[model samples]
Target: MQRPKPAVIDRATALRYMGAAGWQPDAAATALLDKAEALVLDAATPRAALRLLPRSALPTEGQGNDLRRHLEGCSHLLLMAATLGGELDKLLRRLELSDIALATAADAMASVLLEQVCDALEAEQRTYFLQQRGLYLTGRYAPGYGDCPLALNDELCLAIDTVRGCGLAVTEQHLLSPRKSTTAILGAADHPVTGYRAGCATCHLQKKCAYRKRGITCADS
Candidate 1:
């Protein structure tokens, strides 16, 4: 399959996600975004591993209603991710310091970089899938949502090899390393997506989400 062109990270969008995470882009965050971009560009490849299997093959059993709904409305599901390793690991380690003051800068930088990378990946994936037919991206729906089990991360990792190339690894406790990486299922719909919301505003769990309390809105147009 042909790979979509990389999405340019507009400064506005970069700042939006960073701000949502309570991160202001300082010199450190700019550095992290640059480094993360290099890493993602070098490691990204067109993953044909995502076969359009029945939603039943999603590794979740109780997804009958949700899967049925998604299938009826979606044209394809796009899965894109990379393993996090090397420089990325070192970057994350630096951000994991116990001292609040010491780690704040690093944490902000990591947050900005992660969101930028995911946004770029999502844009590219959406374009590629959309070119194939009457499909448009509804939005990315990750595991651990309403009924989507976190256990499905195992299947996601196996299918995408997110650990090998991108250096992203999940812990025994099922937490993704780097604390910045993500695995999401992007549903392709026949109808056009008119809105461009990102963080908490577009999130279905916003009302009850702790992240929303921090003043994060999904208004990333």
Candidate 2:
């Protein structure tokens, strides 16, 4: 297990999460965002865990047609889960009650922070697998993306003991409990991974995405 330091956050990414990526933040908005960033970071307790399992570990059915396609040609699977922990969730709730505006900004900032944590974990594991096992990883594909059922999150969390390991839990609606937590599956193979969609094409949110409407992408965000 490892945790990424929440020392920085990408403003553009946070803006994207706030659905204001296309507009420039005025001083007030900027200051609010900065405050949100500080609050989110101060409340964050990042933690992550990774487990590499044989491809056979996945059930043959109900894993989603697209997910199976995504894992094609891969011999192994990597289960990853990460969280900013319960303190941030509590902070967001407090802000929600006292200042909804700051709560909104803090929520977006927290999303970016969680994304960074996942990215850091993936990068570290990618390097390790490449150097030690001569493997390459496909981009992460999470539950509820495309045809993948969100229910898969429960199995994934169980597989990695997420609750015990990092205080992460799955809700009745299949959402991560902390609300800032995430779990993903990555395919590992001997050859370089290809056909990974880092764009909006396969995104479940593409239909209602602000970035797509503006003819841009949150890929880099």
Candidate 3:
């Protein structure tokens, strides 16, 4: 595991996460977001871990058709976990006690940072496998997408040793702890992969997403 360099958080993405994407921020709101962004950047400590396993090695009991289809034509799966660490969690909690609005901004910024970290990890592995073994990676699919069971997070956590490697934890409720972390699965194939999308089309929350309600998509930001 290697520490990823800090990334500049995208303001639009952060606003989208906060469900305030289209709303114009007043001076007070702008100041609040500025403060929260600074705190999130200061507190964040990015870390990531990845593990590659043969597709057949994964247990089959709970895998859904959607996931199976997503990995079709692939011989191996790449499991990844990434986080902004627990210090960001502590900062968010403290802000929650004093200013809910600021806390909300911080949470959104943290989410963006975590996503950036995951993207970087995925790109890193994609290049590694391509150059080292002539394999290409399918777009990542995570637990809780479509019929993919949320319970799979536990298995994923253990498979990748996310707890010891990156300090990422999976709760009994299937949530990732440090409160700002993510896990994903990517398939490696002998040929180039396609037909995967990360926007509203593939998201399980499509019908209820705040972005959709605003006539936009997460990818828009």
Candidate 4:
């Protein structure tokens, strides 16, 4: 059975996410990250009866066009879900002042948290892929990035039962919960992996990258 290794988050990334919410990574935040990591790891380990239907499986011309135009050459789809415990719900309620406010906050936080979680998961998955001489990740390609359609969230939610299992449901507008959760697609290839440059050029928000603006350099030099 395929098991997802533990989710890892660096202190810096945790700080960044907390900062976005106007909250500093106090003792409470540190404690939360530690607990969240454990919870995510435990949840990720269980295998769900899930299938990743390819772009070909989509029925509509618009969807086909969306996949062909955006997700061309994409080969694999990984679907994962976990039941959201009361703790997550409590966190969401505490952070969100109102429905609209919560939605807005969730949109931003979800992307950050998801990116960190996916990075950790992909690192482990890449190791496995390399051991098998199969494929390794180039980088994660998420919806609403590089022309990938955001509309695919519905498909992802259905594929993984994001609502029933994860307590994460997509609104009519397609946002996730815990105000800091995420789902994404990653590109994999059989080629030997190259280290991700910690430079502006390699960044997804290269042109207007906040990390760059904050003088965060991922460059080896």
Residue-wise lDDT of candidate 3 within 12-39, one digit each (tens)?
8788777666778889988988888889
Please report, in order, the local distance difference test score of every candidate based on alpha carbons: 0.53, 0.85, 0.82, 0.47
* Residue 170 error, candidate 2, Å: 1.4
Candidate 2 — what's its lDDT?
0.85
Estimate TM-scores for all models: 0.60, 0.90, 0.88, 0.52
Write out the backbone clash pairs for model 1: 83-166, 83-167, 83-168, 84-166, 84-167, 84-168, 85-167, 201-218
For model 3, how many clashes?
A: 0
Tens digits of per-residue lDDT for model 1 on 1-221? 22332454344444444443434668875775665555444433332223333344455445434433444555455565533334545544654564343344344444544555566666766777678765677565566554455666778766666665455667777667656567776665678753222344334476776445665434423
- Which of candidates 1 and 3 reaches a greater TM-score? 3
Provide the lDDT at 80 for model 2.
Answer: 92
Which candidate achieves the best TM-score against the true structure?
Answer: 2
True-structure Cα RMSD, model 1:
6.0
What local lDDT score does residue 75 receive in model 4, on the 0 to 100 scale? 49
Q: Which stretches of candidate 2 lie over 4 Å from their true place?
A: 198-208, 211-221
Question: Which residue pairs overlap in candidate 4's backbone?
Answer: 83-165, 198-218, 198-219
For candidate 3, what is the TM-score?
Answer: 0.88
- What's the ranking of the predictions by lDDT, best on top? 2, 3, 1, 4
